[model samples]
Target: MRGETRTVWPAARRVAGGLALLGAATVGYGVYERDAYTLTRREVPILAPGAAPLRLLHLSDLHVTPGQTRKFDWLGELGRLVPDLVAMTGDVLSHQDSSAPLRRALAPLYAFPGVFIPGNNDYYVPKPRSPHHYFKRHPGGPHKGPALDWDGFAKDLVADSGWRDMTHVHDVLTIGGRRLDVRGVDDARSRRDRVALVAGPPEPGADVVLGLSHTPEPRVLDAFTADGVQLTLSGHTHGGQIRLPFVGALVTNCGLDPSRARGLSRWSAAGPDGAQRMSWLHVSAGLGTSPYAPIRLGCRPEATLLTLVPAR
Candidate 1:
């Protein structure tokens, strides 16, 4: 029995040591990949036939704080793209004063016409918690911490800078020589979304119709689809923030499926008649993570530039 015990102990120690090294390596890589930002570009066929192409830039889940100089610089550089319209789904501040950093991150985007709504993170700060909490069906404790300065930021953007506030409303605008019927709701995760207020078919004479939200909960998305939104944009998944090789995202942190956690995909839901309706859905992996749990694995931070061309 003593001889057997000695052999088993050595083997167990070797396995434990190996696992510890692997865990350390993973943490190292996640930290390194956090700042390894990239831009994802895609072409969507949502424009009218023979219509001139329009550039649309989709940015989301900024979650920016001070000292992230690299993020500030990269965002400033996107001005060269000169997108005709910019759609920012929010999560802009991370509990900082946000006066300078918010301006530093978003002021350049205001060079063009844009529309945005606030995320839960914009209303209050996220408290530090274990990463494991994220995987559970229902995370406990207070999700929000200190209050953020959302009103000041809104005034600066909407009142002063001419950007539309798309929170819980639908409106029509002419952009790039085409009529656009745009609708959006607040962050759906916190039950702030009021899709009923903006519910209805696409407006007449609109060249395109779309919707936006911070969290892409299926019910909100389904409502948008039923309302005849041809395209829908959302963020807050962060592409699971820690993807695996073959298995991919273990959880989306929301009701969204793991497969469609990030990037472009078709969203379909059943209508009243039980027939399936579909629309183009683009979920930004997002530009940053919550400051408290700032690590990424196979998924890198990203912004998407979607070139909208004529429908096939």
Candidate 2:
């Protein structure tokens, strides 16, 4: 009996130690992944000329709720990056009344010039879910309410942040005689894209042209390319949000190939006269999960840092 008791004690001690180590590892990984695990990527021969490289920061699909302290802290810390300009694509709030919290969450970005567009999630979605999925998951999946006040939210966002309301519009950024034209459309999920806004290229002498949309639909992509836009930045699919190591993305919402689901992709353009050109396309993975679906598995949220260099 004494001998058996000694052997059992040693095994139990080993099992306890193993459990403790596993718990520590899990906690450590959560912390590491929670902080901005930024992946740096680039495209050389970026089509700009004779100017110092301009740094453009891109963030999207925030879905910020009422009390996301971590997200606010992260945005505030972004002031350390000192980017020349910052742009957000859409879905700023998880719900319409969340505008107050969204404003507070975005206060840090006020230090720099910024632009924003609205996603389908913003305009008609309820507290926990967007209207985009209303019919798909009927019979009561997660959401338990009606739509929201989109007009009031839109007015407040424009008034508070002074953001460029690029819903079917364009704006230009100038530095040392070179120009970067930016054009955007509303959410493709809501089918509000006005392709005409992206049909005309800025007049000659524009150094770079960028297109913005909430989703990466191919029709809009082709239109932007047709307009002589050199780049397009978008965020919607969450980069599959829970990518597997070997299998890659489980799903991609748009025509974007699974390989180009979250990061930079290259697109070729045909000139109005029929000559071919090339450009870069970057898609941010996004910051927060939909309120109805909280918890990201593999893909951590990201803000992209795009350094646009002159063609060599």
The candidate that wins on TM-score is 1
Q: Write the per-residue lDDT of candidate 2 for residues 1-312, one digit (tens) a residue.
A: 999999999999999999999988765764555444453545435764676777777888887767777787777777677766687888776765678877776777776667777776776554555545522312234442456665677677778877677788887866445676889999886678997865686757777788898887777887788777778888887777657788777665666676777888888767687888666778888887676666555788888778888778
Candidate 1 CA-lDDT value: 0.86
Consecutive 10-residue window with the lowest summed lDDT within model 2:
134-143
Which runs of model 1 end up more than 4 angstroms from their true locations?
Answer: 1-14, 270-275
lDDT of 2 at 62: 81
lDDT of 1 by residue, 186-287 (tens): 888887999998888889999888899899899999988877888899998888888989987777777889898898899887766777888888999898
C-alpha local distance difference test of each model:
0.86, 0.73
lDDT of 1 at 97: 74
- How far residue 17's Cα lies from its native spot in candidate 1, in Å, is 3.6
lDDT computed for candidate 2 = 0.73
